[model samples]
Target chain A: GAGVSQSPRYKVAKRGQDVALRCDPISGHVSLFWYQQALGQGPEFLTYFQNEAQLDKSGLPSDRFFAERPEGSVSTLKIQRTQQEDSAVYLCASSRPPGEKLFFGSGTQLSVL
Target chain B: EDKVVQSPLSLVVHEGDTVTLNCSYEVTNFRSLLWYKQEKKAPTFLFMLTSSGIEKKSGRLSSILDKKELSSILNITATQTGDSAIYLCAAKGYGGATNKLIFGTGTLLAVQP
Candidate 1:
């Protein structure tokens, strides 16, 4: 694709429900990252992947938050038993290499009601 | 823990006015500092500063990093209404296997026409 693409630009989920957010990065991007942006705050790193390997997941807030990039081109962020505190924007970004410029997606706004 | 702080939570300025955004960071193994602009959905990349002293300029936007002071500044010359957005500052750090970014709260800039 021309740029990073994310699905379900907006989502409304009830508490305790699970939600899945998808991201399709630029073709052949070697590094993919997931971030969460709260209202009136900057994006916080969630996880990182190099190719198909999940190298880092240190920033995932809790055990309920999980992300995976099985094939390296596309990724998914799954939140289990969502809570009101999870209502925020989930952003995905990609870079050619570890220390290169990143391209971001439009993001999925999750509203837990 | 790595931390990034940006000054002036919000600013309102008239068109053609120049604005300077400040960012400071304290991190171990700092790799780079980045600037991003967020409007409606996602944040767009602006500049990445690695070395100190050298300024990176893109038309009306310019940024410089001061490694000695552990800070960076983004300057916009003759700002426009289109430039009204949240300016974010992030610092990249290498921890274990992957590099992670720590972002500040961001500065909301509103340019009045």
Candidate 2:
């Protein structure tokens, strides 16, 4: 079975640029999540989606960060006006439902200069 | 604030040794605890413990959750160099309000050959 997958393993962007990271969750998974992992630290929550609806975005550090999962399978995390502080690996994970085990993607390592 | 905390931010052990990792949390709507292992890329799921399923074991790795204490412990027997990675703990909140996974700082394990 295919696990979660992410595109563009690495990305380099200048400050104030916009970046979009994509994630493909396993088929039929109802819950999707995005996280930001800074160097030498664990991943921080970003947002979550159930089905095609965006349920939570409280974890988004600022308004510049937005994510969407239309049709409930493919998701994208877009960060507008990138900053050096946002330089980190963006991770995506999916689970059948809340409280279930989550499967994670390889992640996109974004380096903002 | 709701948070997950992991102890022993880093550990260095030789192959065949035993190791233990800890995770504690403080959240209003406690649901479940999860464990993950990561090496350079995305995190791999290790275990998910809820109120009913408190203890889980897979080969050399085992984990237990103490709901009363709001904590969990992961034990690895006969640690191997391949087990060297960062161990993360996350807590899921209850209710239908978006399954946000709050994460701990993580423990970096370096198993020496």
Candidate 3:
């Protein structure tokens, strides 16, 4: 792809419902990252991946938040039993080795109603 | 814990105004400082500052990092309406080679014509 791609640009989920957000990073990028942005705030790190390995998940807010990059090219963020506090924008970014520059996708705006 | 803080939660300026956005950080395993622009959903990368004193510029946008002060500043010269957005600051930590970022609450810049 020309740039990082994400699906379901907007989502509305009821509390306790499950939602899945997808990201397709630039082809062959060595590093991928997930971030969450609350209203009137900056994007915070959620997780990181190198290749197909999930090296860090320290920023995932709770057990309900889960992310995976099984094949290294595409990734998914799954939220189970979503809560109102989870309503925010989920962003995915990708970069090559050394990881100085990141190209982000359009992001998935999830609104838990 | 790694933390980044941005000042002037919101600013209103005219199209020709020159504004400076401030960011201060305290990262445990600090690597680099970064700037991003957010309009609606996605945050576009702007600058990444690792070394002190050297300023990176792209058109009217320039940024510099002061390692001694543990801070960074983003300067926008002759700002335009298109530049109206939330300017974010993030710090990359050596949590791993993957380079996850800790972001600040961001400074919202509203440029009026």
Candidate 4:
């Protein structure tokens, strides 16, 4: 599919382990977003980027949660020293500039033990 | 804080029944209201309502936004078993440099055969 692509569909890591989740947005889609969805809950915004510049990350739970879009096309969300509470599905979505609708990837289900 | 609230956390209905979902929100610089359906992994975009009073429809699904009341409603008529999924309501807000979406917990709908 030409939609957003997420890697490591599922991840299991012991507490204190660091994890990295990747997302490849649709070609030429300028706006990228990261969201966290816990079981039985809607996705919560985590960060936003436009062409390599991360403009917003106010929704990040802590400093340990860091995201970056180095080239503005691909993004990575890195969680350092993971906690059990961090278990959730991390979703990636992209939209064209002046974005009104979003295209989402299947998401990475991260499980921290 | 920007937030979206949805009513009837869960619902079960016969295949031929009609159902209505409600969503209300409060946010700074509200840009749009969006709906998505999540079956298992990816959340598929259903509708994006920006202008008030104009209802957007697609087959059995229709949605309307009300800026005066800061709310929206989604109606699905003669729903099928395939309509069983978690329906998400999100409010897009523009504050600072981010145009992020704040989502409600979601309404779980089960259309029984």
Please name the candidate that would achieve the greatest lDDT relative to the true structure: 4
Model 4 stretches astray by more than 4 angstroms:
none
* DockQ list for all candidates: 0.80, 0.79, 0.76, 0.87
Comparing to the true complex, what docking class would candidate 2 get? medium
Instruction: For residues A13-88, write the lDDT of model 1, one tens digit per residue.
Output: 9999999999999998889999999999999999999999999999999999989899878999999999999999
Q: Is candidate 1 or candidate 2 better by lDDT?
A: 1
Interface RMSD for all numbered candidates? 1.1, 1.2, 1.3, 0.7
DockQ leaderboard ranking: 4, 1, 2, 3
Ranking by TM-score: 4, 1, 3, 2
Regions of model 2 farther than 4 Å from truth: B52-54
The local lDDT score (0 to 100) that residue B107 gets in candidate 2 is 96
The sequence of per-residue lDDT tens digits that candidate 2 reaches over residues B78-112 is 99999999999999877756777788999999999
Please provide, for model 4 over B1-113, each residue's C-alpha lDDT reduced to its tens digit, 9 standing for 90 to 100: 78899988999999999999999999889999999999998999999999999999999999999999999999999999999999999998775787788899999999999
**Lowest summed-lDDT stretch of 10 residues in model 2 chain A?**
A94-103
lDDT of 4 at B44: 98
lDDT of 4 by residue, A25-108 (tens): 999999999999999989999999988999888889999999999987889999999999999999999999887788999999
List the candidate 1 regions with Cα displacement exceeding 4 Å.
Answer: none
Full candidate order by lDDT, most accurate first:
4, 1, 3, 2
Predicted structure 1, TM vs. truth: 0.97
Worst 10 residues of 4 chain A by lDDT: A95-104
